[model samples]
Target: MMPCDSNMTSIVQRIARQALLTFRSPPRIGEEASKSFLENHSKLKSLMTEVRAADLHLVPRRASDSPPAVPVPPPVTYMHICETDQFSMGVFLLKSGASIPLHDHPGMHGMLKVMYGKVRISCFDRLQRSPQAAQPGALRRSVLRSTAEYTEDSDPCVLSPDRDNLHQIDAVDGPTAFMDILAPPYDPDDGRDCHYYRLLTDAEEGEHTEQREQKEKEVWLMEISQPPEFWCGGEPYPGPEVSL
Candidate 1:
């Protein structure tokens, strides 16, 4: 299909519609309908392959461009596409060597599909009710779930409230960008606020460290305020408008 086919709504728009149908009425949407929506999500991934940077009005920087003399701003930026009570969708662009540090989605579910370039994502899962007192503050034990790399040709990375919900994303080699969707979006009043975390290691080094022999590596995490070095600057979404 032609990119931005004027005769039809874009695939992103179709995905938005399906997402709305899937999430708008959670209690009443039924199990079978929910399953169907997941199938739609898979189809959305397949359709994503047809998308190009130009389709989103993004112009990739050429390699020969001279580096700026002044200090450069943060290398990561975001484009707000659309949002509703059910879900929010957007794109994140990261320059070479940039990373979205280890953080969490609280109780949200998410899907991320790379649009261009590549990213390495490290994901973690919090152990249940495992908070303990530490010198600086409270720390919770967690398990390193997976570390995987993704490119435009890869499947979407999926996350749920209880699984692979905490992750760090880093751009590999050169620039990268990905489309992200979060369900029931982040609302502090609703207990879905985003939180940042740092992994902690025991200095004493005992049985806990030896447990690394197990399948999942366990570690402590300390909650903290957003890092001063990282911030997202928003840009207008330039693709076909989505309406739910």
Candidate 2:
């Protein structure tokens, strides 16, 4: 096990403190951040890529093989590491064949780094809404950004308010675990809330406005209730203690 409050802070501890300083005064959406802020963000990204499951003392929590009569638990679990007003850090564990459904992080910046196993992540960017866009109850226009698999050795998947902000993650082949960092954690009162969605076919978009470019297809994503099949349980973080 890693030591806590030692003379030298572990990578996880440093990540927590750096995240605090990096997001304390984040740049406004749609604006370019200052040089110093960008520099700090770059450093943070580097640190995140360096983290491993061993550093956090994490291992995949798989569904039991002998489960005929056993009451199966939720497929996902969250291990809370630490948090501050500016940021929150945690790990999400997914059992084999489990998935975290498509969701949006409203007005936030985030990073996802696989700590173990592998995950296929599909990312999307919400397009600007027009006057003739779908009504309040209809789907929102989004553009598929990318879909890729990542392992512990991969670079972190980064998301910002306006770029690749909505995504779905699925465990590949077996159980998976990843570290998640979100700035200015979701606060419904502050108008920052999480919303779930599912991709709809182009025909379902039903848009009467401009057509999507043939090169880059635009699709619709309908807001949905959190998928009933998925839920997140909790676990204790067994890594070095993080303080900010």
Candidate 3:
């Protein structure tokens, strides 16, 4: 077993325990059980906090020498870790230059901890539509919303229902790895699914109201056609087997 196996086992143990607690009675996430259920799960939350890029033994390597641990622009890759009706955990490894496109998790909660190299996570908040919606033509790109970036050392991003749901992740400078956990694993029937998006750029420089000072530095993404450059290729899960 590798040194990483130790951390994997420890983290899995905590997740499994949380799974059991969640099973006894699905913890209501509102203000009611905020302390007992959510706060008490501080232990598991720390697992993500404790992990760092160096812990996974991730080192920069040329993509041509070996198969990408995750999806490349050519093929999508994913490794199975473990899954239960309540939640699922897995790891995604990206080769240098490869990226997981901007995507959304409709009705789930997730935590991502970097285990290998650095990653740039751009998060976005989705805007609500008014009851008296405007015509499609009137809904210009400017009306959509905000974006932010996160690193391994950054705080965990919270996505509720459909708010702040779309984002893209890119391995920075080199190959990278991150552990991911999604509760009530994506189910299309439940209206929880993943959808990809690309940044909406200002096509006509002076055509639209420009907010260069506020907008140039800020990433305003528009849902455009998916690019062929983004794709994931699968690799082996390097962690200990997780069982709950």
Candidate 4:
């Protein structure tokens, strides 16, 4: 059923509540939450499904108002909402064809709910190896664990401390937006920082050919320098006023 305007207030309230509960004990990648939260607050997920990026007022605008003011692309823009020691909430809006590069949120948990349009999400896991299992200088291996498409109607995509922690999000065709919640957001001092990466050339498929191949099947990756063309423009948040 379509959520009504009247119910939106309640829904947002519930979301904030769940947000707090999640702070107490964040949800796992596959597991929604602790069994207790799952049992008692099952209605929370439904409410989340109803909320879209537009429903909230958060909006992105150019950091400056000057013309000849360098033209910034959507891929370069990122809008961060509230952040604290426990959790953080924000919304991201992307223009058609924009993308958030493949990056990793070290030791974090997150949920992304699409608000409009569609997004192609590619997720990966960094393979761990012992000293003897692999050579020192050899490029580290990364596995393409999964890939999924999300639209406004899709459920939130979940990520945990280690699994599927590395990912890239691309806006499909039209303008798209999504709500994001991160537990204990990126803190360089605390060691929860973000890092960008590129796929390592596959020995079997060859370099360029392997990168062009788009399949979920496990593939290797090597971190490379961040692309110079990529940059984000900043804007204001127009979403519901979050207090706390």
Best-fitting candidate, scored by TM-score: 2
Q: Scored by CA lDDT, what does every candidate get?
A: 0.75, 0.85, 0.58, 0.68
For all predicted structures, in order, the TM-scores are 0.80, 0.89, 0.69, 0.75
lDDT of each residue in 29-92, candidate 2, tens digit only: 7888888889889989999999999999986555554422438677888899988888899999
lDDT of 4 by residue, 130-156 (tens): 254222233545778778999988988
Candidate 1 has a TM-score of 0.80
User: Which digits, one per residue and each the tens of the lDDT, describe model 3 over residues 1-244?
Assistant: 5564644565555665664454334343332434555653465567667755434433434556566354434433566677877777777777776778877675556677776567777666554433442222222232233444455676555454444455577877777667777766888777665665655555633434364444533444444445667655566765545566
Model 3 residue 142 CA deviation in Å:
8.9
RMSD of 4: 6.4
Note the clash tally of each candidate.
0, 0, 11, 13
Q: What TM-score would you give candidate 4 relative to the actual structure? A: 0.75
Misplaced by over 4 Å in model 1 are: 1-7, 25-37, 44-51, 62-72, 130-136, 202-215
Q: Which regions of candidate 4 deviate over 4 angstroms? A: 1-10, 27-33, 37-44, 58-70, 129-138, 203-216
Q: Count backbone overlaps in model 2.
A: 0
Whole-model alpha-carbon lDDT for candidate 4:
0.68
